[model samples]
Target: MNLKFIKRNIFPLVKIISTVLITSAIGLESWNIYAFLTNRNVPSSLNPIFWIERFAMTSHFIESIIAAFYAHSGKKMPIQYATYTFFVGTIGLLELFDQEND
Candidate 1:
């Protein structure tokens, strides 16, 4: 088996899948929020769960903004990134192939 070729090709697939998963999650969440906004029967946005989610998302947004600034300075991340915990499995590629930057 050609391990090197498979190794080289796997990350792009992982990235594309991760991105799709993340996008779908966001899309689903948007639909939820839209339903809440449009239907008075839905729970209030001020619910504790919503506040907790808001804080979590805000923290993640801050990290991405920082990472974007770092990217602008031509310094790549020293570690791998994943959009969600499910995607973290893809980080194994870093250890398997020594691709820590990008």
Candidate 2:
């Protein structure tokens, strides 16, 4: 296969993957926060789950901001962004369903 073709395809794929991952992180974090708030006893900050939830929320927020900037500029974003968005979005959706099932 030609290197050029691979490069072209890879960039788009990357963007999608990133998106999905970021989105998933956000959803998972949100669920964690909700569960904590609803519970009589909140989880400690020192807990690993707390850290994971925080990171996931932060990642999602940052990715969303970047995506907004790219979209508002009316210019095509790099394939990396697209790939990221796709992954994040997918993860977010999955998280939502997972929470619902629980």
Choose the strongest candidate by lDDT: 2
Query: What does candidate 1's lDDT look like per residue over 24-97, in tens digits?
Result: 55665686678879874445654675555455455545554444344423434423331332332333334333
Model 1, 92: alpha-carbon shift in Å? 14
What are the Cα lDDT values of the candidates? 0.49, 0.54
RMSD of 1: 7.6
Best by TM-score: 1
Clashing pairs in 1: none
RMSD of 2: 11.9
The regions of model 1 sitting more than 4 angstroms off are 1-7, 40-63, 75-102
Clash totals in order: 0, 27
- Candidate 1: residue 95 Cα off by (Å): 14
Model 1 Cα shift for residue 19 (angstroms): 1.2
So what's the TM-score on candidate 1? Answer: 0.45
